[model samples]
Target: MIEPVELIGLAAGFLTAFSTVPQSIRIIRVRQAAAVSAGTYFMLLGSYILWLVYGIIQGAISIIFWNVIGIILGAAVLIMKLFIWKD
Candidate 1:
């Protein structure tokens, strides 16, 4: 049986993981990199990696699932900021 905490984690994970879409859309729409900081994205990527690792260690599927997606989205943003930004 799935625990209540696991369900909560799943919900929170889904919300947080998908929350980046708006920011990414804004960046793409405006073509503006002024507000996007490379260091911040990198830090977020690093933190997500750590969270993924922790999820693996804890055998928490919710954490693993969310952080995996978070890593992908975060990396996408970081890459866009790196290549698309003109500084």
Candidate 2:
């Protein structure tokens, strides 16, 4: 059984991981990528990657799991910005 604190942490991580979804959905729905900032995406991607590596080094499953999702979402957003949604 997960401890209460761990569960709370997991829930928070899940929320943070999923926080990228709305913008992704909006970008898909509106098909607008030009408004998205490449700099922001790059920063997010770098941050997620760093977190992923840190998780791996520390054997942190929660960090790994959430960061992987973050990477996917970040990649999608970057892809959309670079290829699919280019103005």
Candidate 3:
């Protein structure tokens, strides 16, 4: 039996992860990320890392899954802001 509650988690995770996409798109489109702060993304990445750690300790699959996605997207934005997209 599929747990319906899991869908909620999946949905939430997807939303949270993809919520960063607009900024990413903007950065890509402009080819500059001067407005984005490296510190903010670093802090966000660190926070998500902690979230993943906590999820691991608690054996919460949804939390771990979401945090992984968050980390990947956050890293993408951070990388773009710091290295690739920034002029």
Tens digits of per-residue lDDT, candidate 2, 1-87, equal 879999899998888677778878999999797778978888888989999999999999999999999989888888888888888
lDDT of 2: 0.88
Order the candidates by lDDT, highest first.
Answer: 2, 3, 1
**Model 2 pairs whose backbones collide:** none
Scanning candidate 2 in windows of ten residues, the lowest lDDT window is 15-24
TM-score of 3: 0.81
Clashes of each: 0, 0, 0
Residue-by-residue lDDT tens digits, candidate 1, 27-50: 889987787888988888898899
Error of 1 at 16 (Å): 2.0
Off by more than 4 A, model 2: none
Model 3 lDDT per residue over 26-66, tens place: 99888789788899889988988998999999999888988
Q: Rank candidates by TM-score, best first.
A: 2, 1, 3
| TM-score of candidate 1 to 2 decimals | 0.85
* Model 1 / residue 81 / CA error / Å: 0.8
